[model samples]
Target: MDDWRSQRIFRPVRWRSRYGRAESGKMHGCADLPGRMAMARKAKLGFGDQATTLVARGTRVTGDILFRGSLEVEGEIAGNVTGEAEAGAQVRVLKEGVICGEVRVPVVVISGRVRGDVYAGEQVHLTASAEVEGNVHYALLEVERGARVSGKLMPAAAGSGGDFADDAPTPGMPAAPK
Candidate 1:
């Protein structure tokens, strides 16, 4: 590492910019260098790190998942999913995917099959060909034409607001409340 202080004061040194400059008798305002580094470290996580992860087609996972990041499911998952409790967190199940367990997340967009309970804190979108046979509790919901939902629709329990509020649906025989 180049030690800024060890350099001769009379020698020319490149300070702020890439261009060279003759060193003066006193040090420049480089004293804030450490603070600038600290500031950069505290900026925050960017959109890339916060972007949703994907489970592509033909893949399968058979265990409970407690993910702290967003996920897009295009394969098969046979376990409980307690997703990250963050804004924009979502689980998108593609037409080829199948999930067979409980899923508690902020947003759920399903175009496949889910044979378990679902609690979406924000919204749930079920596209055509989506077949769900369990309980669904969501603040907002949308189901496309030809979608099959054979389960109950129940109101979410009070207290937990950002997911994890188990709201069992009433019964599959009757249409769920819109």
Candidate 2:
């Protein structure tokens, strides 16, 4: 154990209990002293569907990707990402991940940084730590409190291919400035 943690949490020391009695043993050595950590519950990855691809941390990819099922990005990608979402496919970018190009997938969960636009046919969820520098095209969108977007939010019309035209004004917000 590290010196600070050992002395602070586990080391026996002279202290008094809440009953106003002098305790002769460890400080905060009671059961409340953070005993064995409870086993964490298994998370349902990709909305209960297991991911079929993983761009793990410390890795980098420089080409566009085409995938099925689900893709979980924990690293970096510098190209476009297209996923087949017709069968409930999804893409998840974790907190430390980054994507520098466009993304077209069925569902997108972004908790990292995206430097390009995203097109989600089903839904797009941006968590509090997410940051997007390009527009997002989605059928449904969810934005958390601290998510940041530097581009427009365009709703994908029924037959529109999520055009990237700047002149198409989004609803609610005013037209993009020239």
TM-score of each: 0.62, 0.62
How would you encode candidate 2's per-residue C-alpha lDDT over 19-126 as one tens digit per residue?
A: 787654455656434332232222424433455789999999999998888899999999999887655678999999999999988899999999998888778999
lDDT of 1: 0.75
Q: For candidate 2, list the clashing residue pairs, or say none.
A: none
Lowest-scoring 10 consecutive residues by lDDT in candidate 2? 35-44
Kindly list the per-residue Cα lDDT of model 1 for residues 2-60, writing each as its tens digit. Answer: 77556755344345444565332233535546776777665654543566667789889
Off by over 4 Å in 2: 1-51, 158-178
* Weakest 10 consecutive residues of candidate 1 by summed lDDT: 21-30
Maximum-lDDT candidate: 2
- Go through the candidates in order and give each one's C-alpha lDDT: 0.75, 0.82
Global fold similarity of model 2 (TM-score)? 0.62
